[model samples]
Target: MRPLIVFSDLTLDGYMTGPGDDLGFMVDDPALEAESTGELRNVADAIVVGRKVFPEMSAYWTSAEGDLAHWMNTAPKHLLTTDPSVDTSAWGNTVLEVGDGIERVRELKAKQGGALVVFGGTATVRSLIAADLVDQYWLKINPVLTGAGGSPFTALAGQRRLTLESARAYSSGTVLLVYTS
Candidate 1:
């Protein structure tokens, strides 16, 4: 099966995003960005996102320039959504998937691919983690702390033990932690 990797940016306090989905605390970190891009480029050729995150990502990456944006724009994006009104045509190279999100992801894993990387909003991450579909976790821990915000680990179905694969500290005060189930 093609692996499902969860890619997330986290605050030191473990919040994925501040209240109202604020990402203003996040800073530009070249060192961490380079390392993360290198890792993702090697492992994934496709991207998966939930309904809430799809529009945000598509708008940002479509006209953006850079290696990451290039990958984001070119890679086939699988969007899991139950809303029948969503038009996939406006978002280039997008595939809209209906029904159970986990099941859809499992089907994707069975197909020919390098890896399916999941970039998520809070609810999607919670579901993915709860379903135990994630094989690897790439978390970038930034120095700033968002004391109150949404957490990917919130309201988990059960406990999941992860083995730490590697940890690297970047000059920008960001730490890249890799863990596997």
Candidate 2:
């Protein structure tokens, strides 16, 4: 089984997004995205995202052009959703409906493949964390604080210790923290 990496952005206050789901604090640097996510593209064959994140991800990435966008658009994706009525016709990702939880991820991990990555969905990340399914976490921590916002780690039933693999600081003031569980 290949590694399952959670590649995400978080504010200094540990918020994934600010109030009202404002992502204004996220870095707008194309080079940064290329540098980070682009690296994962080589090893990450598939993406797993929650239903709540797919619409926004699809709408933006389908029209965006770049190496990162190409990976985002072409990756075979598993959209975790209990809703059977969702229109899975999005062109960005080759979308397959999946049960809304971590069981499918568990099964996927047992197979031979490249890494399965969680790019944007916090709920998906949190669920995987709860299930102890995530093998590695690559968090890009931005140097700003959102006093109130969404935390992917919140509401976790218990603690899971992680080993810090590496920490690198980028010129954009975003620090990349990689961990292995």
lDDT of 1 by residue, 24-124 (tens): 77767877777788779899988989998777877878877878888888888899988867877756889888889989998999999898999887788
lDDT of 2 at 130: 76
Q: Candidate 1, residue 176: CA error in Å?
A: 0.7
Residue 74 miss distance in model 1 (angstroms): 0.1
In lDDT terms, how accurate is model 2? 0.82
User: Could you report the Cα RMSD, in angstroms, for every candidate shown?
Assistant: 1.2, 1.6
lDDT of 1: 0.86
The TM-scores of all predictions, comma-separated, are 0.95, 0.92
Q: Candidate 2 residues 47-117, lDDT tens each?
A: 98888888988888889998888888888887888887888787545556567467777777888999999
Candidate lDDT (C-alpha), each: 0.86, 0.82
